[model samples]
Target chain A: MTTEPPPDAHAAFSAVALTAIDDVYRFARSLTRDEVDAEDVVQETYLRAFRSWHTFETGTDVRRWLFTIARNVFLRSREKGKREVTLDDDGAEIVDAALAREAWSRGGLDTILERADLGPAISTALAELPEPYRAVVVLVDLEDQSYESTAEVLEVPIGTVRSRLFRGRKLLQEKLMQHAIDSGLIPQPTAPVRSTE
Target chain B: MNHGHGSDDRTGAAAMDCAGAMDRLFDFLDGELGPETEVRIRQHLEKCGHCFDEAGFERRFLAAVQAARAAEVCPATLRARVRDALRHAGWTEAAGS
Candidate 1:
């Protein structure tokens, strides 16, 4: 059964939702990490968005509303069981800091960032990250969304967004660090020579 | 994490130490910290070389991540597919146009 939307409601959806297609598609691609699946997710997302057009509150962010719908669509399309990752925010931050310190000591990550082209490496690495972390990184960093907006989109706490973002960036950095070493952009780690007394 | 020397005033001259600065580095980079804490961290960074370098690396790394997917947009075929799906579900360009 189809319920026709009022003309004004349809116009509003067109103005806001249609304009956000690119952003929504980019977000879906990040979630799916596969072009075909991303297309499917986007198609379904728009369909749902149009049907629920009246439910979207005016003067609020259209992209955020659309993103929430898109995320739900992606989740539904995934396996039957939704994977829940329990994050010990404090512990995770501690580990992330430790790993970052180690990476810095091994061979300056700043040097790698300056010397190497991270575009290809980053895309591959982002694709490889776990969905929980990848989604946060994509929304917050790639899409330039705020923490509050991303939290709402992912249906997680702001703290969760912070932790996931930190973890995601660290994981991606680890991958890029390896790529830099493999590509000879940075020298292999070497032990310091002891001073002879 | 050794947060830093216990100082009640975050924006004062007696700002946090390297440990404190490093602890809040990610939040600082992400603009998630409060203004007072931000000032304190900024002051600490000005005086602390190690923390400053770490923050710089993190900042650049984030910028790189943002750059990686910057060029990607919705493909034309996907756009058409979505539009078609919307039309099939009773959306009309006339209403929107």
Candidate 2:
């Protein structure tokens, strides 16, 4: 006769997997950028995860595994084609820290937090980022995943994760700076100085 | 990766310049830098008011993003749906055996 797992085995699986439910859903929403699609992806991720539970290593990171699966499912769907924007390198140079500090002290960061309403502005900015950059930011900055773990989740080299994260944060900063100016908190300064030294 | 710092000795030299410090700002903040490199950057920030403010702004910006993300809670209905699906799958597996 075939042996069966004890009834509590399923319960144990649910307990551990359910702890990551919110994380998975939030990641799904960030990737899909649409409520319906995000919900569908989360559902599909859970089902696939359940079916493949036997393959999961006992001590490994379950969260990253779920994210990998979720991202794969999203990519397989037709909506993937619509979300492939790449980072624009023409404006990706690092800003001079001294000038950037001057601008920020002159109401840049404060204005972004106060007038633009931090939560919504950040959410919108994150959503507007190109997909590759957005994924890195979401996985690293927002989710607090390590660069190594993020590399694994995105299936890219650690160097790519670092570069994407740097560029992504830079882009987000630019957006917030613009928001600060548009909110009348600060006047736009001359273009950021390109340091040749 | 060497920014032309000729000697391995970082101390007693002039503090890191703006470019050098800024290049490692994120890595420094993320705790990814080696202890010696981190000390060099920290020493630079101590002397460079401008770089300090720049680092401060980025730190706060990252904190704000984390706060915003923490505020997001998963919907109850979705949690329930996932729970039910797992339950059904479990039953199905048991029956098939």
Candidate 3:
């Protein structure tokens, strides 16, 4: 026998949680990196959120709440170890920015960014990124969540979010550069470059 | 890391140079820094064309990534599936009733 949800609960769930289906689905897809697995995660997320609708405080950020639940569901489904990555990222930001500048100047990445239809390529690059960095980038850059909010969702400290976010951007930049070169969007380097520095 | 930008100690935006400004470019672009720091970086950018250009490239890159992902939405099938699951779990909202 099922205890039916009350009228208001149904209305509230529909209004708040259901409205964020797209955003939550995108976040789930970023985490799982597979459409089928992502759909499963989103389904479970909505069901769990609906079941616990009473616990959700009204007038808060619905998207953040749903994202928290979705992330947890994906993690549990994978049942992998903790995804925390230790960082010695003291100068990584400067180094990454400089290298990206080098790539941009060398490859005319400005043109690639402006004129190219990059949705598929960006998705592929993002899918290939490691989990920790991908999560931060998706939450902060794609989902437009702030660092503080992202930290809360990922259950990491604020510093971790910043470091991973920078590192993720760096990796994606490098990958996109290579993608451009491979796709003939940019010319191959005249000299076989050895070091990124 | 070090772009040879002396100590991290600086008085204000007046003392901030290209290296210091460039180092904090991501934080500035992300709007993650405090007001004073943000103002300092902005002030430096306003005066320094080189750092400003570098910041522009990075900013555009981030915007491109955001634009790429913005088009994706929850698929219709997943939406229907969730609606059905909700109904099964006592949601009581009939479809097209």
Best TM-score among the predictions, by candidate number: 3
Clashes (N, CA, C under 3 Å) per candidate: 0, 0, 0
Tens digits of lDDT, candidate 2, A1-20: 12333565555456666678
Candidate 2's C-alpha runs over 4 A off are A1-6, A78-106, A111-117, A178-197, B1-15, B91-97
Query: Which candidate number would show the highest lDDT if scored against the true structure?
Result: 3
What TM-score, computed on C-alpha atoms, does each candidate reach? 0.80, 0.77, 0.83
Clash pairs, model 2 backbone? none
Residue lDDT tens for model 1, A57-100: 88988888999999888878865226433445543654465464
Q: Best by DockQ, which number?
A: 1
Residue A75, candidate 1: Cα error in Å is: 2.4
Candidate 3 chain A, which ten residues in sequence have the lowest lDDT sum? A81-90
List DockQ for all candidates: 0.44, 0.30, 0.40
- How would you order the candidates by TM-score, starting with the best? 3, 1, 2
DockQ winner, 2 or 3 = 3
Model 1 chain A — which ten-residue stretch has the worst lDDT?
A: A188-197
Model 3, position A196, has a per-residue lDDT of 36
TM-score of 1: 0.80
Q: lDDT tens digits, residues B17-90, model 1?
A: 88878877887787767667778889888888888778887888888877777567788888878878887887
